[model samples]
Target: MAKNTGGNSLKLKKFLNRDNTVGYVFALPFIIGFLGFTIVPMIVSLYFSFTNYNMISAPQWVGLKNYVRMFTEDNRFVNSVGVTLKYVFISVPLKLIFALIVAFLLTRKSKAVSVYRSVYYIPSLIGGSVAVSLVWKQLFSTKGLINNILHSLGMARISWFGDEHAAVWPLILMAIWQFGSSMIIFAAGLTQIPASYYEAARIDGAGIVKQFFFITLPSLSPVILFNLVMQMITGFMSFTQTYVISNGTGDPNDATNFFALYIYNQAFKYFDMGYASAMAWILLILISLITFIIFKTSSTWVFYENE
Candidate 1:
């Protein structure tokens, strides 16, 4: 019995060693790249967050000065935070809702379904690009396509980029136009939902609206949660559209000065590396905390079909 047990242990050890070897081989590129790029930079940035590391000079330890200054001295940081929060709160839900609606529409059997989906998704592909933002800037300009159409319709032209209040709307519109990713996710989720459930609800004399609220929404809760979390995170981290559309200044009284844009300004524009690193870490913490809260709250609403 002892000899058999020893033989079994040896076999298990060999199997485990082979598995480890295969895992390492599969993970080699990622491990090497992570250590070389991501891990090293993270470590360096962690250290830099505590030090004044202007590009011209060696880093000097500043303890918590950067963080303290950010909280107390920097009004811009506070304003950026407020702007980011507003953008996130406004854009995320609109994006998710629009995506869900489009996805639902796409799920219907129509000849033009794929074409509509493709058209909706095209904006998302282009919306984040500098070229697209430039085009959006042009389109929202006083004499541009949108205003020209409004003018052609006998309406007064609105200042899209000039007015602080109106300037943010263009960004919001741009975000809403890029609902493709979320739409795709919603489409996938819609497909996973069993048609039998809907059929049963219909047999029970449930209308489309009733079936949607009771059957569709409940079934799509997990996807809704996923899209919500992702949209929130993406909204918070938005930069390129604002940067390109606002001409990299976050102009018109800093209305478009998102948190990430503010961090870029701090790190690159102003050479406040330490403060920028602190802000990056703060944003990281904020995202992590928000995600954790979502996960915690998900237990009540997120219906896992497997369980």
Candidate 2:
């Protein structure tokens, strides 16, 4: 028996080594791209973060000047940070909740479910396009379709892009409208949950609300955590809607200026590549910290059956 066990171990090691060789052969292109694009750019960005490099000139070592200015001197940086935080916290939760509700509704098995899922997912496929964002911007303009309908209803006219208070609302709406990705994930998670649990819960006198609260939520918490992290990251990285809608200005006095937009403006618009690199690193660090905190707290709320 001992000899057989040793032979099995040798065979397993040989199989694993062979598998790894085949995997590396298949992954060669990805490995090259990763090294040339992602890893190299990250290393260069880290170095540039410590310097002041305009596109036209060599980088000058500024030590921590860029970081200091970002924290203490740049009001636009502060505004962008605040705007990003609000967008992430508010939009992430709302998007996830909307996705969860839709997922639940869509889980009711029907012949039309596949078609309905594809139809709903259309928005996610097109939501980030410049044309769609342009249309959305026009939709909320002073004399646009929404306000026209409002006026026909005897409502007052309002400037969506001219007011700081209202400028970000349309963006949030756009974000929520594209909850299809999360909805699909939730739907998949819902299907994984055993029907026996629900049947048992019903037998114990639980109604819909109680079942959702006590069974469905706990079972779906892992999926929710995944969606939350992904959406939060996407929220922080969001730029296209703001860029296209505001014509790359993040208008309404910068009310819709997200972190990525600010970084873009700093890099390309002002040619402050070094400062932009610093901002990028800051964003990376911030994302890492937020993700870490979520993972740390996940053990308290995120449930897994095998665990």
Put down candidate 2 lDDT per residue, 1-307, tens digits, no spaces: 9999999999888886897877997899999999999999999999899999987779999999999999999999989989999988888899889888888878978879978988888889899899899999899999999889989999987798999998998899899999998999999999999999999999999998898889889999998999889999999999999998888888889999999999999999999999999999999999999999999999999999998
- Write the residue-wise lDDT of candidate 1 on 1-307 in tens digits: 9999999999888876897887997899999999999999999898899999888899999999988988899888888888888888888889988898788768975668878888889998877888998899999998999999999999999998898888888898888888998998898899988889989998999997787789878899999998899889988899999988887888889888999999999899989898899899889988899899989999998888988
In order, what lDDT does every prediction score? 0.89, 0.92
lDDT, model 2:
0.92
Instruction: Return the clash pairs for model 1, or none.
Output: none
- Give the lDDT of residue 100 in candidate 1: 83
Candidate 2 lDDT at 181 equals 89
Using Cα atoms with residue i matched to residue i, what is each candidate's TM-score against the true structure? 0.90, 0.91
The C-alpha stretches of model 2 lying farther than 4 A from their native spots are 1-20, 152-154
TM-score quality measure for candidate 1: 0.90
